[model samples]
Target: MRYKNLIFDADHTLINYTADERDALKRIFEEIGLKFSDKMLDRCCYLSEFTWTETGLYDVKNERIQREYHNLYKTHLDLLFTRIFTEFPCSFSPIRAGELLLKYLKDGTNSISHAEETIKKLKTEKGYNIYIATNGLIDIQVGRLKRFAPYLDGLFISEELKEIKPNPLFFKKILERLNCTVKECLMIGDSLLSDIAGADGVGMDSCWFNPKSKENQSGTKPRYEIKDLTDLLQIL
Candidate 1:
């Protein structure tokens, strides 16, 4: 009732990312003549999960995750790619891999479950200035938004601005760009470290989209917490 702008996170909040990542990984392996393995998948899962607090790389956006989350599997694949003549006669190019990854991200068939109808309803019916504030690669996030949720308006991504949320500067940058007061904006996201803390720092209200039932451990409080995004209609 008091907010003028509605900000949302892209990955889990809007676009279902786990399903997307799995498909992308399989495509990358197929290109390299390798089948997706449970073991390799586990390593990637750990890196993405722990990279935030474990490595402090929460704001760093990525196109090819293997480049950043380097594990034994990627190293092995690189070696396999070198002997292309023997490893099935195809080539492996980093550029090509990057393109494939982006393709997987943009493909709606690969996206996680989304409340697309709810987002459309909220914006056209409720008149909220919807925006995406995600901590993922800008190109990918933008592409996903354009394809799936074009009805929304502004986007504040970490890659484009050179800052990640939960860092005070991240929220500050968005606030300055939008020229909106903190009291007039609401941050809704899955990550407490990034979205919740970042919004709280700027004296803005936040809604914790806890779809996974994760605990913050840091004890920060969000303005609201909801298990399902459909619940957003109640608050908005």
Candidate 2:
């Protein structure tokens, strides 16, 4: 095999999180009196992850410095809230919804999902030493990593490292920890900008999981590509 070490993204790639996120956000809206409907909330939830890395719509804030993804995410959330406020037929409080949304995102643990049995296969069948490199929080990532994807060797989360993805330093940090050169590693993720671009920047190979046939517009290129998690077995 050309690739030996494998680095995976946490959400969407290894975990089925979009649906849980939407349901949590919807619950928050209803709790706060904002009235998150089944259809509208679902649309926003689906759109957020679908367009996540490519669409530039995410509010991923960091204590160090804000990133474009974070800015766009906030903008998208604001727009969603604005629409809910003005367009919704029911009366509600946006503040409460926002509170619920934050709490839900932080408190919900099982919200982290696995990509079917792919995680198990990667550990047992493939015998690939796997690790997660993501912009997720440390506590949440560690907790979820332990529960859903116990096969992982380690987790590199931005909140703990004080850095986010697509930055060469983030990848470099993992390389140092693993004592592996860039050539020995492969990054598998759903985002071109964060995961793929970051890995490529370090001269490391990457596999982009294009679930939505988004290659036409992503503009960023990866070392390899796959459409589904099951397809990953064929690549490795």
Candidate 3:
């Protein structure tokens, strides 16, 4: 095999984060006595992504911003609902709503189409060591990824590692933990910024999992691009 280690990104790439997030958001709204609507869900999703990016989660090149993000990550979940629902008046506490959302999200183990099969094939059939590299909350990610435990050799979460993706240090730490060289690993993920850029920053190979066929406005380029998970089989 050309690559001995397959480092997959959790959200969108493997785990169906959008599906899980929609479910979690609906459940939280219902639990908090708010009428759930698709419009509400869309608004929430928009705000969630906006806030995450604004909070420096994707600021890969700035050392000061990265350090600030590390400090903010601890209370990120606690303040998420508060930030999202600032315009809407709610009877329930935002913190409690956040906790409930976390609970529902943790129980959501939905995976992308062909994700499990691809992972199993890569690990068992192709003899590649499969792993997950994510910048998600540790508690939620660990719970959701438990189903992949049989195939996964290890998981790297930025929350625990104290570094986020697109940073060379984060990939460096992962390489050290795997005891593998950059050339031996291939990062596969949907995010061009986090996964492709991060891997490339470390002089590693990457495959952009662009299932949506989204245009790549970002300057960072991946070594390969695939619209489906099974395409990785051919690339490897």
- Please tell me which predicted candidate would have the highest lDDT against the true structure: 3
Write one digit per residue (lDDT tens) for candidate 2, span 76-156. 555555455665554555544544555565544442223647767877888878888988656556655565556778888
lDDT ranking, high to low: 3, 1, 2
Q: Best-fitting candidate, measured by TM-score?
A: 3
Ordered by TM-score, highest first, the candidates read 3, 1, 2
Residue 102 CA displacement from its true place in model 3, Å: 2.1
Itemize residue pairs with steric clashes in candidate 3.
Answer: none
Which should have the higher TM-score, number 1 or number 2?
A: 1
Taking the candidates one at a time, how many backbone clashes does each contain?
1, 4, 0
Scored against the true structure, residue 156 in model 3 reaches a CA lDDT of 97
Q: How well is each residue in 1-236 modelled by candidate 3, as lDDT tens digits?
A: 78889999998999998789889988888776777678878888887777677776667667876666655553565566786677566767777877787789898877999999999998999999999999867888899999899999999998888888878999999999989899999999999888998898989999999998999998988999999999988888
Model 2's lDDT to the true fold?
0.69
What C-alpha lDDT do the candidate models reach, one value each?
0.69, 0.69, 0.85
**What is the RMSD, in Å, between candidate 1 and the native fold over all Cα?**
5.8
Candidate 1 residues 197-216, lDDT tens each? Answer: 87888899999989778876
Residue 203 miss distance in model 2 (angstroms)? 0.4
